[model samples]
Target: MKAPPHFIRNNEEWIIWLLEAEFSGSATPHALSSRTGISLDTIHDNFLYMERVGLLSIERDPDKRYPEEIARVNLTENSLRVYDELKIRPDPGDLF
Candidate 1:
């Protein structure tokens, strides 16, 4: 599936989710969606793309990616740093 127009609009949310997860010891898709407002569908789809592209690691639990076994959004060192500097959540009604 094609990503949402704004799915990659700002790298902040993506970076934050990954950084937060890495720092917090792993996170679920829900965490990323809640922070980014990218929608669960979008998150999963992009995650799959990330896996396909090998930017990060991806493991499935019966064809599903769960926090217990994997981080939905993986953060590289750069992403982690970007997230550390990023503040403020995206405004409501701006998720599209």
Candidate 2:
């Protein structure tokens, strides 16, 4: 599905869309960064912002490395609602 024209167009939209469409609502920040070509730090920053806004829930694992400490990231109901509304899906040909 394509994002509606009125949908908030930003990196975070792509992040949440990826989570909903491909990852079953949960994935590592590192994997997301790899998939989206967004930096790990940027993904972490977005996660924090999304969490604060009640869009995402982040789980940290100290057993992992620095950024990987953010072991898992999941979309919240609010985010899922947005995804359902926007229906944004990146073209598979556009991804690595």
Per-prediction TM-score to the true structure, in the order listed: 0.46, 0.77
Query: Per-residue lDDT for 1-96 in model 1, tens only?
Result: 222223334534453444464446245666666655667766666666655654434445565444333444455555445444443445345765
The per-prediction tally of clashing pairs is 0, 0
Please identify model 2 stretches exceeding 4 Å from their true place: 1-8, 63-66, 88-96
Task: Supply the TM-score for candidate 1.
Answer: 0.46
Model 2 — TM-score against the truth?
Answer: 0.77
Q: Could you tell me which 10 consecutive residues in candidate 2 have the lowest summed lDDT?
A: 1-10
Which predicted model would earn the best lDDT? 2
Residue-level lDDT of model 2, residues 63-95, one tens digit each, is 886666888999999999988876755544545
lDDT score for residue 59 of model 2:
92
Candidate 2 global CA lDDT score: 0.81
Model 1 segments more than 4 A misplaced: 1-25, 63-73, 76-96
lDDT of model 1, residue 36: 59
